[model samples]
Target: MTRQKATLIGFSAILLWALLALMTIGSAPVPPFLLNALCFGIGGVIGLVWIGFGAGFGVLRQISWKVYAFGTIGLFGYHALYFTAFRIAPFAETGLIAYLWPLFIVLFSGLLPGERLRALHVIGALVAFVGAGLIVMGRGDAAGAVPVLGLSLAFLCALSWAGYSVLSRRLGDVPTESVVVYCLLTAALSVPAHLLWEVTVWPQGGWGWLSVVGLGLGPVGLAFFTWDIGMKKGDIQLLGVASYAAPLLSTLALIAAGLAEAKPILLLAALMITGGAALAARASLKP
Candidate 1:
Protein backbone atom coordinates (compact mmCIF):
# COMPACT_ATOMS: atom_id res chain seq x y z
CA MET A 1 0.00 0.00 0.00
CA THR A 2 1.10 3.58 -0.57
CA ARG A 3 2.15 5.50 2.56
CA GLN A 4 -1.00 7.60 2.50
CA LYS A 5 -3.30 4.61 2.15
CA ALA A 6 -1.43 2.72 4.83
CA THR A 7 -1.58 5.71 7.18
CA LEU A 8 -5.31 6.03 6.59
CA ILE A 9 -5.71 2.37 7.47
CA GLY A 10 -3.77 2.98 10.66
CA PHE A 11 -5.99 5.93 11.51
CA SER A 12 -9.04 3.70 11.12
CA ALA A 13 -7.77 1.66 14.06
CA ILE A 14 -7.87 4.81 16.18
CA LEU A 15 -11.55 5.31 15.41
CA LEU A 16 -12.33 1.68 16.15
CA TRP A 17 -10.51 1.87 19.49
CA ALA A 18 -12.68 4.86 20.41
CA LEU A 19 -15.60 2.48 20.84
CA LEU A 20 -13.68 0.28 23.26
CA ALA A 21 -14.03 2.50 26.31
CA LEU A 22 -17.81 2.51 25.86
CA MET A 23 -17.95 -1.23 25.20
CA THR A 24 -15.91 -1.92 28.32
CA ILE A 25 -18.71 -0.45 30.41
CA GLY A 26 -20.83 -3.02 32.32
CA SER A 27 -18.14 -5.65 31.65
CA ALA A 28 -17.29 -5.46 35.25
CA PRO A 29 -16.83 -8.24 37.81
CA VAL A 30 -15.30 -9.98 34.82
CA PRO A 31 -11.53 -9.97 35.20
CA PRO A 32 -9.56 -8.03 32.63
CA PHE A 33 -7.55 -11.11 31.74
CA LEU A 34 -10.69 -13.15 31.06
CA LEU A 35 -12.16 -10.42 28.90
CA ASN A 36 -8.98 -10.04 26.89
CA ALA A 37 -8.58 -13.81 26.61
CA LEU A 38 -12.00 -14.24 25.04
CA CYS A 39 -11.73 -11.15 22.86
CA PHE A 40 -8.32 -11.98 21.39
CA GLY A 41 -9.03 -15.71 21.32
CA ILE A 42 -12.12 -15.22 19.20
CA GLY A 43 -10.22 -12.68 17.19
CA GLY A 44 -7.50 -15.21 16.50
CA VAL A 45 -10.09 -17.71 15.30
CA ILE A 46 -11.54 -15.13 12.93
CA GLY A 47 -8.08 -14.38 11.62
CA LEU A 48 -7.41 -18.04 10.99
CA VAL A 49 -10.68 -18.34 9.18
CA TRP A 50 -9.87 -15.37 7.01
CA ILE A 51 -6.42 -16.60 6.09
CA GLY A 52 -7.51 -20.21 5.80
CA PHE A 53 -5.07 -23.13 6.05
CA GLY A 54 -3.19 -22.63 2.78
CA ALA A 55 -0.55 -19.96 2.10
CA GLY A 56 -1.55 -18.26 5.33
CA PHE A 57 -0.56 -21.19 7.48
CA GLY A 58 2.57 -21.48 5.41
CA VAL A 59 3.48 -17.88 6.23
CA LEU A 60 3.47 -18.56 9.95
CA ARG A 61 6.44 -20.87 9.72
CA GLN A 62 8.62 -18.14 8.27
CA ILE A 63 8.12 -15.81 11.26
CA SER A 64 10.80 -15.86 13.89
CA TRP A 65 9.73 -17.09 17.32
CA LYS A 66 11.35 -13.97 18.76
CA VAL A 67 8.89 -11.85 16.82
CA TYR A 68 5.99 -13.92 18.10
CA ALA A 69 7.21 -13.70 21.69
CA PHE A 70 7.84 -9.95 21.82
CA GLY A 71 4.86 -9.02 19.70
CA THR A 72 2.48 -11.00 21.87
CA ILE A 73 3.94 -9.50 25.02
CA GLY A 74 3.47 -5.99 23.69
CA LEU A 75 -0.10 -6.50 22.46
CA PHE A 76 -1.42 -8.68 25.28
CA GLY A 77 0.40 -6.79 27.96
CA TYR A 78 -1.15 -3.53 26.82
CA HIS A 79 -4.67 -5.02 26.85
CA ALA A 80 -4.30 -6.63 30.24
CA LEU A 81 -2.84 -3.54 31.81
CA TYR A 82 -5.42 -1.27 30.18
CA PHE A 83 -8.33 -3.39 31.42
CA THR A 84 -6.81 -3.53 34.86
CA ALA A 85 -6.60 0.26 34.96
CA PHE A 86 -10.24 0.59 33.96
CA ARG A 87 -11.17 -1.57 36.92
CA ILE A 88 -9.12 0.61 39.24
CA ALA A 89 -9.88 4.07 37.85
CA PRO A 90 -12.27 5.92 35.59
CA PHE A 91 -12.04 4.90 31.95
CA ALA A 92 -11.70 8.50 30.81
CA GLU A 93 -8.70 9.13 33.03
CA THR A 94 -6.99 5.87 32.18
CA GLY A 95 -7.66 6.35 28.51
CA LEU A 96 -5.74 9.61 28.52
CA ILE A 97 -2.84 8.02 30.34
CA ALA A 98 -2.75 5.09 27.95
CA TYR A 99 -2.50 7.47 25.03
CA LEU A 100 1.05 8.32 25.98
CA TRP A 101 1.95 5.59 23.50
CA PRO A 102 1.80 7.92 20.54
CA LEU A 103 4.25 10.28 22.15
CA PHE A 104 6.35 7.30 23.07
CA ILE A 105 6.22 6.20 19.45
CA VAL A 106 7.34 9.60 18.24
CA LEU A 107 10.24 9.61 20.69
CA PHE A 108 11.22 6.02 19.98
CA SER A 109 11.20 6.76 16.29
CA GLY A 110 14.23 8.92 16.83
CA LEU A 111 16.16 5.78 17.73
CA LEU A 112 15.38 4.19 14.42
CA PRO A 113 17.76 4.63 11.52
CA GLY A 114 16.86 7.54 9.21
CA GLU A 115 14.35 9.01 11.67
CA ARG A 116 15.40 12.20 13.45
CA LEU A 117 13.69 13.87 16.37
CA ARG A 118 13.10 17.46 15.37
CA ALA A 119 12.56 20.43 17.70
CA LEU A 120 8.89 20.52 16.83
CA HIS A 121 8.50 16.89 17.87
CA VAL A 122 9.85 17.65 21.35
CA ILE A 123 7.51 20.62 21.71
CA GLY A 124 4.60 18.50 20.56
CA ALA A 125 5.30 15.79 23.08
CA LEU A 126 5.42 18.33 25.87
CA VAL A 127 2.17 19.93 24.76
CA ALA A 128 0.34 16.61 24.58
CA PHE A 129 1.63 15.58 27.97
CA VAL A 130 0.36 18.81 29.40
CA GLY A 131 -3.04 18.01 27.97
CA ALA A 132 -2.93 14.60 29.59
CA GLY A 133 -2.20 16.24 32.91
CA LEU A 134 -5.26 18.44 32.56
CA ILE A 135 -7.55 15.50 31.93
CA VAL A 136 -6.19 13.55 34.86
CA MET A 137 -6.47 16.47 37.24
CA GLY A 138 -9.95 17.31 36.05
CA ARG A 139 -11.41 13.95 37.00
CA GLY A 140 -13.96 14.13 39.84
CA ASP A 141 -14.06 10.49 40.84
CA ALA A 142 -14.90 10.19 44.53
CA ALA A 143 -12.77 13.00 46.03
CA GLY A 144 -10.93 13.48 42.74
CA ALA A 145 -8.21 11.03 43.54
CA VAL A 146 -6.72 8.85 40.81
CA PRO A 147 -5.28 5.60 42.01
CA VAL A 148 -1.51 5.51 41.80
CA LEU A 149 -1.37 1.88 40.81
CA GLY A 150 -3.99 2.30 38.14
CA LEU A 151 -2.26 5.32 36.66
CA SER A 152 1.07 3.51 36.65
CA LEU A 153 -0.34 0.52 34.87
CA ALA A 154 -1.95 2.78 32.31
CA PHE A 155 1.40 4.41 31.59
CA LEU A 156 2.89 0.96 31.24
CA CYS A 157 0.22 0.21 28.68
CA ALA A 158 1.46 3.15 26.65
CA LEU A 159 5.04 1.99 26.92
CA SER A 160 4.13 -1.54 25.93
CA TRP A 161 2.27 -0.31 22.87
CA ALA A 162 5.16 1.90 21.87
CA GLY A 163 7.43 -1.11 22.04
CA TYR A 164 5.02 -3.11 19.93
CA SER A 165 4.73 -0.46 17.21
CA VAL A 166 8.45 0.18 17.02
CA LEU A 167 9.18 -3.52 16.97
CA SER A 168 6.70 -3.85 14.14
CA ARG A 169 8.81 -1.44 12.11
CA ARG A 170 11.82 -3.63 12.73
CA LEU A 171 9.90 -6.75 11.74
CA GLY A 172 7.89 -4.93 9.09
CA ASP A 173 8.87 -7.57 6.62
CA VAL A 174 6.95 -10.27 8.54
CA PRO A 175 3.80 -11.49 6.86
CA THR A 176 0.65 -9.88 8.20
CA GLU A 177 -0.94 -13.36 8.44
CA SER A 178 1.52 -14.02 11.26
CA VAL A 179 -0.66 -11.83 13.49
CA VAL A 180 -2.74 -14.94 14.07
CA VAL A 181 0.32 -16.43 15.70
CA TYR A 182 0.60 -13.33 17.89
CA CYS A 183 -3.06 -13.53 18.85
CA LEU A 184 -2.79 -17.22 19.67
CA LEU A 185 0.16 -16.55 21.88
CA THR A 186 -1.85 -13.85 23.64
CA ALA A 187 -4.72 -16.30 24.21
CA ALA A 188 -2.39 -18.95 25.59
CA LEU A 189 -0.83 -16.60 28.13
CA SER A 190 -4.21 -15.18 29.08
CA VAL A 191 -5.40 -18.63 30.11
CA PRO A 192 -2.80 -18.83 32.84
CA ALA A 193 -3.24 -15.16 33.71
CA HIS A 194 -6.98 -15.56 34.13
CA LEU A 195 -6.59 -18.61 36.32
CA LEU A 196 -3.99 -16.99 38.51
CA TRP A 197 -5.41 -13.53 39.20
CA GLU A 198 -9.05 -13.21 38.21
CA VAL A 199 -12.45 -14.69 38.90
CA THR A 200 -13.79 -16.00 35.62
CA VAL A 201 -16.89 -14.04 34.72
CA TRP A 202 -18.15 -14.12 31.17
CA PRO A 203 -19.89 -11.02 29.91
CA GLN A 204 -23.59 -11.14 30.74
CA GLY A 205 -26.62 -9.75 28.84
CA GLY A 206 -27.07 -8.76 25.22
CA TRP A 207 -25.05 -5.59 25.35
CA GLY A 208 -22.23 -7.46 27.01
CA TRP A 209 -22.03 -10.07 24.30
CA LEU A 210 -22.31 -7.40 21.65
CA SER A 211 -19.42 -5.52 23.18
CA VAL A 212 -17.31 -8.65 23.24
CA VAL A 213 -18.05 -9.40 19.61
CA GLY A 214 -17.40 -5.84 18.59
CA LEU A 215 -14.09 -5.82 20.44
CA GLY A 216 -12.97 -9.07 18.86
CA LEU A 217 -13.88 -8.04 15.35
CA GLY A 218 -12.74 -4.47 15.57
CA PRO A 219 -9.84 -3.68 17.91
CA VAL A 220 -8.60 -7.15 18.69
CA GLY A 221 -9.01 -8.76 15.29
CA LEU A 222 -9.10 -6.73 12.09
CA ALA A 223 -7.58 -3.59 13.56
CA PHE A 224 -4.39 -5.42 14.36
CA PHE A 225 -4.15 -6.80 10.87
CA THR A 226 -4.58 -3.39 9.32
CA TRP A 227 -2.26 -1.78 11.85
CA ASP A 228 0.48 -4.27 11.11
CA ILE A 229 0.32 -3.38 7.46
CA GLY A 230 0.18 0.35 8.18
CA MET A 231 3.02 0.43 10.65
CA LYS A 232 5.10 -1.61 8.26
CA LYS A 233 4.46 0.51 5.19
CA GLY A 234 2.98 3.87 6.27
CA ASP A 235 4.67 7.10 7.20
CA ILE A 236 5.47 6.35 10.81
CA GLN A 237 5.63 10.00 11.81
CA LEU A 238 2.23 10.69 10.36
CA LEU A 239 0.75 7.67 12.06
CA GLY A 240 2.14 8.85 15.38
CA VAL A 241 0.56 12.26 14.92
CA ALA A 242 -2.77 10.78 13.87
CA SER A 243 -2.93 8.52 16.91
CA TYR A 244 -3.55 11.58 19.10
CA ALA A 245 -7.14 11.34 17.91
CA ALA A 246 -7.81 8.03 19.69
CA PRO A 247 -8.15 9.31 23.25
CA LEU A 248 -10.23 12.27 22.14
CA LEU A 249 -12.48 10.03 20.10
CA SER A 250 -12.66 7.46 22.90
CA THR A 251 -13.70 10.09 25.44
CA LEU A 252 -16.33 11.30 23.03
CA ALA A 253 -17.57 7.76 22.61
CA LEU A 254 -17.88 7.44 26.35
CA ILE A 255 -19.92 10.61 26.53
CA ALA A 256 -22.17 9.49 23.70
CA ALA A 257 -22.80 6.24 25.53
CA GLY A 258 -23.69 8.17 28.71
CA LEU A 259 -20.75 6.55 30.40
CA ALA A 260 -19.17 10.00 30.87
CA GLU A 261 -20.23 13.60 30.94
CA ALA A 262 -19.02 16.11 28.41
CA LYS A 263 -16.98 18.82 30.06
CA PRO A 264 -15.26 22.03 28.98
CA ILE A 265 -11.98 20.71 30.33
CA LEU A 266 -12.28 17.78 28.00
CA LEU A 267 -12.56 20.10 25.05
CA LEU A 268 -9.56 22.06 26.20
CA ALA A 269 -7.58 18.88 26.58
CA ALA A 270 -8.56 17.84 23.11
CA LEU A 271 -7.40 21.17 21.72
CA MET A 272 -3.99 20.86 23.32
CA ILE A 273 -3.55 17.34 22.07
CA THR A 274 -4.72 18.29 18.61
CA GLY A 275 -2.34 21.20 18.50
CA GLY A 276 0.57 19.02 19.55
CA ALA A 277 -0.34 16.40 16.97
CA ALA A 278 -0.58 19.07 14.30
CA LEU A 279 2.80 20.44 15.14
CA ALA A 280 4.31 17.00 15.04
CA ALA A 281 2.74 16.34 11.68
CA ARG A 282 3.71 19.70 10.22
CA ALA A 283 6.66 18.48 8.21
CA SER A 284 5.16 15.13 7.31
CA LEU A 285 1.65 16.37 6.55
CA LYS A 286 2.21 16.04 2.84
CA PRO A 287 4.42 13.00 2.97
Candidate 2:
Protein backbone atom coordinates (compact mmCIF):
# COMPACT_ATOMS: atom_id res chain seq x y z
CA MET A 1 0.00 0.00 0.00
CA THR A 2 1.12 3.56 -0.64
CA ARG A 3 1.97 5.96 2.21
CA GLN A 4 -1.17 7.99 1.60
CA LYS A 5 -3.36 4.92 1.72
CA ALA A 6 -1.65 3.81 4.90
CA THR A 7 -2.35 7.16 6.54
CA LEU A 8 -6.03 6.89 5.68
CA ILE A 9 -6.13 3.39 7.10
CA GLY A 10 -4.43 4.58 10.27
CA PHE A 11 -7.05 7.27 10.80
CA SER A 12 -9.78 4.75 10.00
CA ALA A 13 -8.47 2.37 12.64
CA ILE A 14 -8.71 4.97 15.40
CA LEU A 15 -12.16 6.00 14.31
CA LEU A 16 -13.19 2.39 14.42
CA TRP A 17 -11.91 2.09 17.97
CA ALA A 18 -13.84 5.21 18.83
CA LEU A 19 -16.90 3.64 17.32
CA LEU A 20 -16.52 0.59 19.55
CA ALA A 21 -16.30 2.77 22.61
CA LEU A 22 -19.40 4.58 21.43
CA MET A 23 -21.21 1.30 21.04
CA THR A 24 -20.29 0.27 24.55
CA ILE A 25 -22.48 3.03 25.92
CA GLY A 26 -25.45 1.22 24.43
CA SER A 27 -24.10 -2.32 24.52
CA ALA A 28 -26.58 -4.99 25.61
CA PRO A 29 -26.67 -7.48 28.45
CA VAL A 30 -23.68 -9.70 27.77
CA PRO A 31 -21.43 -9.94 30.74
CA PRO A 32 -18.60 -7.54 29.84
CA PHE A 33 -16.16 -10.42 30.07
CA LEU A 34 -17.99 -12.70 27.67
CA LEU A 35 -18.66 -9.80 25.37
CA ASN A 36 -14.99 -8.78 25.24
CA ALA A 37 -13.75 -12.26 24.47
CA LEU A 38 -16.25 -13.09 21.77
CA CYS A 39 -15.55 -9.80 20.07
CA PHE A 40 -11.75 -9.93 20.15
CA GLY A 41 -11.41 -13.64 19.47
CA ILE A 42 -13.63 -13.43 16.45
CA GLY A 43 -11.69 -10.40 15.23
CA GLY A 44 -8.27 -12.05 15.17
CA VAL A 45 -9.55 -15.25 13.62
CA ILE A 46 -11.08 -13.33 10.77
CA GLY A 47 -7.84 -11.45 10.20
CA LEU A 48 -5.88 -14.69 10.04
CA VAL A 49 -8.49 -16.15 7.71
CA TRP A 50 -8.07 -13.18 5.42
CA ILE A 51 -4.32 -13.64 5.53
CA GLY A 52 -4.63 -17.33 4.76
CA PHE A 53 -6.95 -16.66 1.83
CA GLY A 54 -4.52 -14.17 0.32
CA ALA A 55 -1.39 -16.31 0.77
CA GLY A 56 -2.66 -19.81 1.48
CA PHE A 57 -1.20 -19.86 5.02
CA GLY A 58 2.25 -19.70 3.40
CA VAL A 59 2.72 -16.15 4.66
CA LEU A 60 1.87 -17.23 8.19
CA ARG A 61 4.66 -19.77 7.87
CA GLN A 62 7.03 -16.82 7.80
CA ILE A 63 6.09 -15.61 11.31
CA SER A 64 8.16 -16.38 14.40
CA TRP A 65 6.14 -18.52 16.79
CA LYS A 66 8.00 -16.97 19.70
CA VAL A 67 6.90 -13.53 18.63
CA TYR A 68 3.34 -14.72 18.14
CA ALA A 69 3.41 -16.32 21.59
CA PHE A 70 4.57 -13.16 23.28
CA GLY A 71 1.98 -11.17 21.33
CA THR A 72 -0.76 -13.47 22.63
CA ILE A 73 0.37 -13.01 26.20
CA GLY A 74 0.66 -9.28 25.73
CA LEU A 75 -2.79 -9.06 24.22
CA PHE A 76 -4.26 -11.19 26.98
CA GLY A 77 -2.77 -8.84 29.51
CA TYR A 78 -3.88 -5.74 27.60
CA HIS A 79 -7.58 -6.61 27.29
CA ALA A 80 -8.06 -8.30 30.65
CA LEU A 81 -6.37 -5.48 32.48
CA TYR A 82 -8.45 -2.95 30.54
CA PHE A 83 -11.77 -4.74 31.06
CA THR A 84 -11.12 -5.14 34.76
CA ALA A 85 -10.86 -1.38 35.07
CA PHE A 86 -14.46 -1.00 33.97
CA ARG A 87 -15.51 -3.09 36.93
CA ILE A 88 -14.13 -0.48 39.28
CA ALA A 89 -14.18 2.76 37.37
CA PRO A 90 -16.23 4.79 34.91
CA PHE A 91 -15.68 4.53 31.16
CA ALA A 92 -14.18 8.00 30.85
CA GLU A 93 -11.65 7.36 33.57
CA THR A 94 -10.73 3.89 32.43
CA GLY A 95 -10.51 4.90 28.81
CA LEU A 96 -8.29 7.90 29.51
CA ILE A 97 -5.97 5.97 31.76
CA ALA A 98 -5.66 3.10 29.32
CA TYR A 99 -4.55 5.39 26.53
CA LEU A 100 -1.40 6.30 28.44
CA TRP A 101 0.32 3.74 26.21
CA PRO A 102 1.55 6.34 23.78
CA LEU A 103 3.78 7.90 26.44
CA PHE A 104 4.92 4.47 27.55
CA ILE A 105 5.84 3.66 23.94
CA VAL A 106 7.65 6.96 23.60
CA LEU A 107 9.80 5.92 26.50
CA PHE A 108 10.48 2.34 25.40
CA SER A 109 10.38 2.28 21.60
CA GLY A 110 14.06 3.30 21.56
CA LEU A 111 15.07 -0.03 23.08
CA LEU A 112 13.68 -1.94 20.09
CA PRO A 113 16.79 -1.12 17.96
CA GLY A 114 15.17 0.56 14.95
CA GLU A 115 12.76 2.95 16.64
CA ARG A 116 13.63 6.06 18.67
CA LEU A 117 11.88 9.01 20.24
CA ARG A 118 13.89 12.23 20.17
CA ALA A 119 13.54 15.51 22.11
CA LEU A 120 10.42 16.68 20.31
CA HIS A 121 9.01 13.25 20.97
CA VAL A 122 9.51 13.83 24.66
CA ILE A 123 7.91 17.28 24.47
CA GLY A 124 5.00 16.00 22.48
CA ALA A 125 4.50 13.16 24.91
CA LEU A 126 4.49 15.46 27.90
CA VAL A 127 2.01 17.78 26.21
CA ALA A 128 -0.17 14.87 25.30
CA PHE A 129 -0.15 13.69 28.89
CA VAL A 130 -1.35 17.02 30.17
CA GLY A 131 -4.00 17.08 27.49
CA ALA A 132 -5.25 13.61 28.37
CA GLY A 133 -5.49 14.51 32.03
CA LEU A 134 -7.35 17.67 31.17
CA ILE A 135 -9.81 15.80 29.03
CA VAL A 136 -10.58 13.35 31.82
CA MET A 137 -10.75 15.92 34.58
CA GLY A 138 -12.77 18.34 32.51
CA ARG A 139 -15.85 16.21 32.88
CA GLY A 140 -16.38 17.25 36.49
CA ASP A 141 -18.14 13.95 37.08
CA ALA A 142 -16.36 13.06 40.25
CA ALA A 143 -18.26 9.81 40.43
CA GLY A 144 -16.53 8.72 37.23
CA ALA A 145 -13.09 9.74 38.39
CA VAL A 146 -10.40 7.12 38.38
CA PRO A 147 -10.08 5.41 41.73
CA VAL A 148 -6.69 4.34 43.05
CA LEU A 149 -7.08 0.69 42.08
CA GLY A 150 -8.64 1.42 38.72
CA LEU A 151 -5.92 3.93 37.87
CA SER A 152 -3.21 1.40 38.55
CA LEU A 153 -4.81 -1.37 36.51
CA ALA A 154 -5.71 0.94 33.67
CA PHE A 155 -2.10 2.04 33.30
CA LEU A 156 -1.08 -1.59 33.46
CA CYS A 157 -3.34 -2.14 30.48
CA ALA A 158 -1.65 0.80 28.81
CA LEU A 159 1.79 -0.65 29.51
CA SER A 160 0.78 -4.03 28.14
CA TRP A 161 -0.54 -2.41 24.99
CA ALA A 162 2.67 -0.42 24.66
CA GLY A 163 4.70 -3.55 25.13
CA TYR A 164 2.65 -5.36 22.52
CA SER A 165 3.17 -2.63 19.92
CA VAL A 166 6.91 -2.22 20.49
CA LEU A 167 7.62 -5.92 20.79
CA SER A 168 5.63 -6.75 17.67
CA ARG A 169 7.78 -4.30 15.73
CA ARG A 170 10.91 -6.02 16.96
CA LEU A 171 9.84 -9.32 15.37
CA GLY A 172 12.20 -8.18 12.59
CA ASP A 173 11.09 -10.38 9.71
CA VAL A 174 7.81 -11.70 11.10
CA PRO A 175 4.90 -10.92 8.86
CA THR A 176 2.70 -8.25 10.45
CA GLU A 177 -0.35 -10.27 9.45
CA SER A 178 0.85 -13.25 11.44
CA VAL A 179 1.62 -11.16 14.51
CA VAL A 180 -1.87 -9.65 14.43
CA VAL A 181 -3.50 -13.05 14.02
CA TYR A 182 -1.50 -14.32 16.95
CA CYS A 183 -2.64 -11.47 19.16
CA LEU A 184 -6.19 -12.64 18.62
CA LEU A 185 -5.12 -16.08 19.74
CA THR A 186 -4.53 -14.45 23.10
CA ALA A 187 -8.24 -13.68 23.21
CA ALA A 188 -8.95 -17.38 22.95
CA LEU A 189 -7.42 -17.71 26.39
CA SER A 190 -9.27 -14.65 27.59
CA VAL A 191 -12.77 -15.83 26.54
CA PRO A 192 -12.74 -18.99 28.60
CA ALA A 193 -11.61 -17.07 31.64
CA HIS A 194 -14.29 -14.51 30.95
CA LEU A 195 -16.95 -17.18 30.62
CA LEU A 196 -15.89 -18.79 33.86
CA TRP A 197 -16.10 -15.51 35.69
CA GLU A 198 -19.49 -14.73 34.20
CA VAL A 199 -21.01 -18.12 35.14
CA THR A 200 -19.72 -17.75 38.67
CA VAL A 201 -20.19 -14.09 39.44
CA TRP A 202 -22.43 -12.42 36.81
CA PRO A 203 -25.22 -13.35 34.46
CA GLN A 204 -26.05 -12.29 30.91
CA GLY A 205 -29.04 -12.36 28.59
CA GLY A 206 -29.74 -13.12 24.94
CA TRP A 207 -29.54 -9.44 24.02
CA GLY A 208 -26.07 -9.40 25.47
CA TRP A 209 -25.09 -12.33 23.29
CA LEU A 210 -26.35 -10.51 20.24
CA SER A 211 -24.41 -7.40 21.15
CA VAL A 212 -21.26 -9.37 21.70
CA VAL A 213 -21.64 -10.98 18.29
CA GLY A 214 -22.07 -7.59 16.73
CA LEU A 215 -18.95 -6.34 18.47
CA GLY A 216 -17.06 -9.44 17.44
CA LEU A 217 -17.87 -8.84 13.80
CA GLY A 218 -17.60 -5.07 13.64
CA PRO A 219 -15.09 -3.75 16.17
CA VAL A 220 -12.90 -6.71 16.95
CA GLY A 221 -12.58 -8.50 13.61
CA LEU A 222 -12.78 -5.66 11.14
CA ALA A 223 -10.93 -3.13 13.26
CA PHE A 224 -7.80 -5.20 13.87
CA PHE A 225 -7.37 -6.07 10.22
CA THR A 226 -7.65 -2.41 9.35
CA TRP A 227 -5.10 -1.52 12.02
CA ASP A 228 -2.59 -4.21 11.05
CA ILE A 229 -2.77 -3.28 7.39
CA GLY A 230 -2.20 0.35 8.29
CA MET A 231 0.69 -0.23 10.69
CA LYS A 232 2.62 -2.44 8.31
CA LYS A 233 2.49 0.19 5.61
CA GLY A 234 3.35 3.36 7.51
CA ASP A 235 5.18 4.96 10.43
CA ILE A 236 3.95 3.76 13.83
CA GLN A 237 4.14 7.27 15.26
CA LEU A 238 1.74 8.51 12.64
CA LEU A 239 -0.73 5.86 13.66
CA GLY A 240 -0.25 6.60 17.36
CA VAL A 241 -0.74 10.30 16.77
CA ALA A 242 -3.93 9.66 14.88
CA SER A 243 -5.28 7.72 17.87
CA TYR A 244 -5.63 10.89 19.92
CA ALA A 245 -8.82 11.33 17.96
CA ALA A 246 -10.43 8.58 20.02
CA PRO A 247 -11.09 10.80 23.01
CA LEU A 248 -12.75 13.40 20.85
CA LEU A 249 -14.91 10.88 19.12
CA SER A 250 -15.73 9.20 22.41
CA THR A 251 -16.75 12.50 23.98
CA LEU A 252 -19.06 13.13 21.07
CA ALA A 253 -20.44 9.68 21.81
CA LEU A 254 -21.03 10.64 25.41
CA ILE A 255 -23.01 13.63 24.30
CA ALA A 256 -25.15 11.58 21.95
CA ALA A 257 -25.77 9.03 24.66
CA GLY A 258 -26.97 11.81 26.98
CA LEU A 259 -24.68 10.54 29.68
CA ALA A 260 -22.96 13.90 29.84
CA GLU A 261 -23.74 17.42 28.79
CA ALA A 262 -21.33 18.94 26.29
CA LYS A 263 -19.33 21.76 27.69
CA PRO A 264 -17.29 24.45 25.97
CA ILE A 265 -14.40 23.95 28.36
CA LEU A 266 -14.20 20.27 27.50
CA LEU A 267 -14.29 21.09 23.82
CA LEU A 268 -11.33 23.49 24.13
CA ALA A 269 -9.33 20.91 26.01
CA ALA A 270 -9.98 18.47 23.21
CA LEU A 271 -8.77 21.08 20.77
CA MET A 272 -5.54 21.71 22.64
CA ILE A 273 -4.78 18.02 23.00
CA THR A 274 -5.59 17.02 19.42
CA GLY A 275 -3.99 20.19 18.02
CA GLY A 276 -0.78 19.62 19.95
CA ALA A 277 -0.74 16.01 18.91
CA ALA A 278 -1.16 17.03 15.27
CA LEU A 279 1.70 19.53 15.55
CA ALA A 280 3.92 16.90 17.10
CA ALA A 281 2.95 14.50 14.36
CA ARG A 282 4.19 17.09 11.85
CA ALA A 283 7.76 16.89 13.16
CA SER A 284 7.94 13.39 11.70
CA LEU A 285 7.76 14.82 8.18
CA LYS A 286 11.22 16.31 8.40
CA PRO A 287 13.26 13.13 8.63
**Candidate No. with top lDDT:** 1
Residue ranges of candidate 2 with Cα displaced over 4 Å: 102-116, 135-146, 179-184, 200-210, 263-269
lDDT of 2 at 286: 44
Work out the TM-score per prediction.
0.92, 0.79
Q: Model 1, range 181-251, lDDT digits (tens) per residue?
A: 88888988899989998778888888888888888888777889888888898878878887877878887
Best by TM-score: 1
In candidate 2 the C-alpha lDDT for residue 126 amounts to 68
Whole-model lDDT, model 2 = 0.63
- Give one clash count per candidate, in the order shown: 0, 2
Cα lDDT tens digits for candidate 2, 1-287: 68778667756767766656545544543445665666677776777777767766777766667767776777667666766676666665556556666556545555556555567666666676676577556657773654768667876977787777766555535555774565467666767777667653322465445556666676555765566655556567767677767667766776787755566755665555555555555554345
lDDT of 1 at 119: 78
